[model samples]
Target: MTEQTSLWQDETQSADFAELCSALYEREIAQLANADIQSPQVIQGRLKSLPYYIKRTAHLMLQTQTPLDLDVQNASWSAKQAAHMPLSGQEIAEVNKWYLAQTLTHGLVVPVATTTHIVLDSIDRIDQQNHRFRTNVHGWFYLNDTEQKDKKVNANYRLLKPNKRVMTAACTGHCWVNDHKTNPVIPSLRELLLSCAINWRNFKQPVIF
Candidate 1:
């Protein structure tokens, strides 16, 4: 690398970058929670500002030189796998809907912008080879829509790889996900938010569960 490029890389590898990433991550999640709202339109407006926060958090993490914790490392590994997997638009929407519902259900807030950033950033990181994954959404969070009769159309994610399971979502904007057999339930969206909250409360640690 050229000297200029080398210096930039070195700066990213510094302890300061790690601290910045940690702080940004906490801020992003906390901001989502603090934006709690009942009106979808109002919530949408609040969500509009999330992409900047998400991107900043992601960029800092990618530039950091420190070794990430197991959960984060594993999440990145899953993103790599997902990049290779074929995710249809409908599939993506299904997963996003499930997550949104779960977040609202758990009394945690998530704007559409945040969800888009999380999904797109994971894919972008893999495509650009950024060598980082900052999202925990690695599965299809929807079930097959054809089988539903009432068309209530709740979020049922169908995760691929690691586990080819279906997550039957609740319609009450609650964080509930059960499988077809209801045996091995996937991680609910509420859990993800709670992890983020805990990480923020615990000195702005990196929590991408």
Candidate 2:
């Protein structure tokens, strides 16, 4: 077996495998982000190609028994039982960095036409003109309440009151819009990460969620 293949089979080297995969993933993200794309079509094409690149990179880095067949739409591969092996402290940190990069990439991608219905779970009234709210699925949104009147503000609050849901479209500039005529809500990336159970502050530890 090749040295890399042996490394994959060695349970003790699981951390090393995780580190390698994380590095490769980071490199791919960097290359994609730094590319000089002159047009929207080019950007879309690159985004479309990311999945295949990820699959191929994982298979090559893991040296799995069954190589990932890119031709098959649903083919999948994973590192042997070692995939479930607990990662070391450093490995966890490296993995978290990769996760953060992935999230940032998601934020950078152009918004699609699809819209989702999200139920508001809670709200934090920031001030007269701005507020923040959390959703059950999508995460936190920053609502700009330009209308300062208490009656109008209360009406807007009622529109997004807890337990009330609305149709939302993800847009550029981290902005999300509801089907209702209310002002557009911008997503707070930090709070959004927290809502997803990822704490950006403690990258040194493994994420329990």
Poorest 10 consecutive residues by lDDT, candidate 1: 162-171
Weakest 10 consecutive residues of candidate 2 by summed lDDT: 163-172
What is the C-alpha lDDT profile of model 2 across 34-62, one tens digit per residue? Answer: 88878989888866876565544444434
* Top lDDT prediction, candidate number: 2
Off by over 4 Å in 2: 1-17, 64-209
State residue 54's C-alpha deviation in candidate 1, in Å. 12
Error in Å for residue 108 of model 2: 37
True-structure RMSD, every candidate:
16.5, 16.3
Could you tell me how far off, in angstroms, the CA of residue 172 lies in candidate 2 after the best superposition? 39
- Could you give candidate 1's per-residue lDDT for residues 10-62 as a string of tens digits? 88556444554465456445655776667888766756855564455445335
